[model samples]
Target: SQQGEEDPQALSIQEGENATMNCSYKTSINNLQWYRQNSGRGLVHLILIRSNEREKHSGRLRVTLDTSKKSSSLLITASRAADTASYFCATPISNFGNEKLTFGTGTRLTIIP
Candidate 1:
């Protein structure tokens, strides 16, 4: 079962502007994680917000989670060209007796320089 999915398959923004992406999930989650990946590169962890938390910040990244709505949003302030990448949201799921992370489809963000 797919747990989480990001809205807006793609986004384009001007450098120094702000970018926002959203994610929605199907079930309860202990925490949600956001990740970034450059073209042909591995994914890098961005930020994680727990179910008990409403918002979190890291660097220029701000993440907000609304467990009641089963949704989350990521905001990037002062976007730069280097920030061009695909963003994904992930949630841990328990299948059978094991736990694994399920990632969303992703949102491709392009920063115009």
Candidate 2:
């Protein structure tokens, strides 16, 4: 499957704590992106890391990519209850102008106050 696998399917943490999620893929990819979905509804794009990039940071989020190992990790620092959601890693599928995003098995996070 082109879709990757995310570890620790679920996590529960206290507010202000840090949350981390890991993903591993099987094949080569041009880029990797992370998203958050609330209540199984809309997805909010968080970060994108290209194959050439080893790491990136945005606000409270940090993303790391290791193409050599075909793995990625997302870290959310000082998480809040509002951060509770299901997070997914996505890669692209393309063919002759046709492109689609394929998502990995997601990690559900719950933050308690």
Candidate 3:
């Protein structure tokens, strides 16, 4: 089974609005990371929140984790059309020397021009 899944496979919003997405996963992980991908481009790391961390923020992005439920949430404040892209969450295996990350199908976010 895949480790992570993002709800609302698709999201559409107007410019300047906020966007939020939820991710659920199975199994334990050392850390989870958020990434953004633009068309024909590689994914860029947005934030990495460890299991011990409940919340983290970077610029307009906020991420919260609930280890008890193996879930996480991402909040983006002041969205822009530039934010239009696919968002993915990755759960890195919890073990020393582990280097693999399982990714979610992703949520395609659309911001109106």
Candidate 4:
């Protein structure tokens, strides 16, 4: 039931600038993941960081997690016009015998040319 929520409902920036997004969750999670979705397209998994991990990076994407604060942040460096998309944070929910993943509302990022 709505585990995470992303900050900055929407973001706009120039092509060469950097973009940063944040997420906060209500309950404990085993892992947190980031995803990107282009307009009218499906999502692409970006990175996943375990609860024990503080930070992780893949290519131009960097993610940091703070379990104590129940928050996570995603940073995209050297943003390009093609980077315009919606980013979301996801967390797994385990209750009784039902287990599934819940996604945050998402942050819409627009990279201007």
Candidate 5:
């Protein structure tokens, strides 16, 4: 399926701490994206790191992609209670001329205050 699978299905950390999650995929991809969902809310795009790029940062969020390992990692520094959410990693799959995103098994993160 080439779908990514996130490790540590669930995680809990104190506020102001850092949170990290890992995602592993079965096949090669051009880029990977991270998304966050807060409870009943929809998924919000966090970051995207391309295969050619080793690392990228957006605000307090840092994303790293290792093409050789077929894996990616997401880091949220100084996490807050508001950061509590389910995080998913997505990879694009091309079928014919169309492209769609396939998501990973999410990691539920709880930031304790």
Candidate 6:
């Protein structure tokens, strides 16, 4: 089964404000990955943090993982209007079948001008 669910199906904030989102999963996993997709563009890998790790950062983005609680969080600091995009959490699934990842529905983030 898939292992993660992001909170707040949608979010809106003025440009330059930080945006925060949460994710919760249901099963044990090898790793967690985050992605961003802009309209008409393909999903882009944002960052990847292994299960053995707790937190990771990339540029203005910060991510935290809690194995015990089966949850993760992503934070985009000083967000810009151009930062508007859909964010998704990917939990690595078992080798069962050929499935490599189970992606959550995702959170729609809108950065207001």
Per-residue error (Å), model 4, residue 7: 1.0
lDDT of 1 by residue, 21-97 (tens): 99999998999999999996999999999999999999999999999899999999999999999999999998897
The best candidate in terms of TM-score: 5
How many collisions per candidate?
0, 0, 0, 0, 0, 1
Note the residue pairs that clash in candidate 6. Answer: 3-25
lDDT of 5 by residue, 14-73 (tens): 999999999999887888999999996999999988889999999999999998889899
Error of 6 at 45 (Å): 0.4
- lDDT, each prediction: 0.94, 0.95, 0.91, 0.94, 0.94, 0.90
- Candidate 6 runs further than 4 Å off: 96-99
- How far does residue 90 in candidate 1 sit from its true spot (Å)? 0.1
lDDT of 4: 0.94
lDDT of 4 by residue, 43-74 (tens): 99999999999999999999999999999999
TM-score of 2: 0.96
Q: What is the lDDT of candidate 5?
A: 0.94
| Cα error of candidate 1 at position 109, Å | 0.3
Write candidate 2's Cα lDDT for 39-82 as tens digits.
98999999999999999999999999999999999999999999
Ranking by TM-score: 5, 2, 1, 4, 3, 6
For TM-score, candidate 2 versus 4, the one ahead is 2
Model 5 clashing residue pairs (backbone)? none
How much lDDT does candidate 3 score?
A: 0.91
Q: Please identify which of the two predictions, 1 or 5, would achieve the higher TM-score against the true structure.
A: 5
Q: After aligning candidate 3 to the native by TM-score, how far in Å is the CA of 112 from where it should be?
A: 0.7
* TM-score, cand. 5 vs. native: 0.97
